[model samples]
Target: MTGDVGRAIGFAVVGALALLAPLLEGRVDDRVAAVGTVAPFVVVAAVAYLSTSGPLFELFARPGDREEGRLYGLASFSLGIAGLAVIYVAFEFPVSAFLVAVFALTVGNLGQELTARYTPDPAVGTSAFAVLGTIGAVCAMLLAGVLGASVPALPLAVFVAASGALLGALIRSVLFVRDDSLVVLSVGLVVWFFLELGLAPTLRRVGIGIALTAALGYVAYGLGTASVTGMLTGVLLALFTVVLGGFGWFVLLVTFFGLGGLASKYRYDEKLDRGIAQENEGARGGGNVLANSAVALVAVVAFAVSGHVGVPSAVFRFAFAGAVAAALADTFSSEFGGLFDTPRLITTLRPVAPGTDGAVTWQGVVAGLVGSAIIGGLSGVFFGLNAPGVLLVVFAGVVGMTVDSLLGATLEGDYLGNQGVNLLATLSAGLVAGLAALWL
Candidate 1:
């Protein structure tokens, strides 16, 4: 077999063994089971060390840097063994966790190899890294949980620091084909340390949520529903909500995005035929997402931080609800209004084209109200808002939507853009909600 084919088969065999090791736990003799458990790690370490001289080296190393590549490869291999030893001796991770770690390492290395070999498509390479990073994160979380149970904080911290350092070093070598180990090591340690402290219980959920959100965003970009920058912006927004507000907030955000996306696509061809469709054919950009969500993200951050300062959490809760409600309202109004034949300008109240700036129609107005009410109702249910609180959110949404139109009529496409208008509207809604919360 060719060298590449031989290496591929070897990696595949190691992965299969790692996966099956856990299943063979009780069935085999004690010594044999122990050997099985350690076999994968040995294979991995050997591959990491020997790969520098093999086809795998060509994948990760630039043509002119073979010597540096060998040094980094040896360092990575040594660190991998050291990390496994720490897990085995210090944390005493179970065979299951070891198997998971082995599987993660295998998958990550495979992804790295594939990404390095395929240089034609940058998106594919990015996607591969994203997938592998996500898998590694999940596996790390699982291993951390297993080791953290009944352990003191100090040991947990040590474990996290060590794992981060090793992984960061390996990643640097793979990505840069050089040894910038300390830089990435410090970054990884700080990031993982904070993650452990802030999101200990929800690490797995956060990992899975982020991974799925990234996948969805990529799909949206691929489908021309959103730009690449928009997809990245959405991913950050989703990550913040998932980390700060938990699953409920994530759900609320997803609901609004899904509904708004569907509405944008409704009668798309008809809108295009009439020359009234959205610019870029409704493909949103980073500016669009941030305009609608920046205020909400600020609220989430404020809410998260308020727990330490004895501030009432309701303030930020209402602010978040109002911001999201305004975003939904604006989206529904703009998208559905374009379907009306004789819309009227918000400022002059005279007949205007369906998609004219500041245009409004009865059907569009009702749709906007319904959309806002949906978010308001969900906030009430999710955040324990009273009747008056819900009403205040809905009121704020309506006011914000009106403000958007007023701004669009005068400033949009003149001194301001669509993103600027959306930003001001959402900010106004958040401010309104905050003020209302003081009274209610």
Candidate 2:
């Protein structure tokens, strides 16, 4: 048999054994069960170490990388065990849920390898693997429910499958990391996180989330506003926003995306002549999507999990808007800054060339304010934010925009890229709004 197949079969056998923990909960400590699940990986690592240049080494290692595969493979096991431990230990979720997560996730990996081998097209293989993995995960979750775990089977199944598909794709395609260890950690962490938060999306909510995200993502991809990977990442974020944050949050996110696309497309020729066009004619790639929206995604997710953090739900809601507001503000500040006025350095107040980093214009600042006010007004209507809250959102947005400028003028060109600056600025805005919600 192939080494890959052999390794997968090994995982299947171990995963099956580990998943019995829930059934044995009355008699065995779950922690002990976790250790037992991890123990095999240690044994594998030892074999990889001692069996260098032998058949066992070949079994543990992928071609070309040889022994290095063992490192990633062990790391994958460690991360998976740790993520499951967090769910079952720190949060004290159903041991069955934890064990099932372990089983379902690795099973999906095994399934992926098996399915990918015969598929000729890489794209088809990926899609098939994701579908098969989702089916396997759903089956595992539903079966775990029958075994008496307190998990919400169908809802959890949909979420876990969606998350796994996206995360598995992300770690491999976008992040360019070793997926063996990290996919398990990241996907399992997100899955268990939802379980811990008790954020159960009704079937209708899930359906709406899927429908809206798919439609918008397809539109965006068709319009050249986002690349294929960009569309997937955006859709995943939108799904979480729609299901967890509901309409109030989802609308703001959509508005933000719309606003960014419009801003990028406006007067494209003029910006191009100025030698400051958005890179790649404003087509957002995976990195761009992640950099720009990571803050908003975190805000929405935090809002969903806020009840456990002792923060009021409204805080995360406002933070979400503020994050988008800041992102829009930055987009407007950059895209239109040179169209109407002479730019000045934000830090020095000295006249500077248009497109110069950290340069600002009166028109751009006003435009940014308009963007923030739009978000604030929507927040009042959708979020039921009082006047003060609306005002705070605007304030926080301005703060975020300013942070972007300050970073751009000083560190952006020299120390950080535009994406990095955008991330930090948006995060600052989000934190400011969250804090303002708490204090003011």
Candidate achieving the largest TM-score: 2
lDDT of 2 by residue, 277-348 (tens): 877777677777788789889888888888888888888887898888888888887877767558999999
**Cα lDDT computed for each candidate against the true fold:** 0.63, 0.71
Candidate 1 global lDDT: 0.63
Off by over 4 Å in 2: 1-36, 39-62, 65-132, 148-150, 175-178, 265-273, 308-310, 338-341, 386-391
- Candidate 1, residue 3: the lDDT equals 38
TM-score of each: 0.62, 0.77
Best by lDDT: 2
Worst 10 residues of 1 by lDDT: 149-158
Candidate 2 lowest-lDDT run of ten: 121-130
Please report the TM-score between candidate 1 and the true structure: 0.62
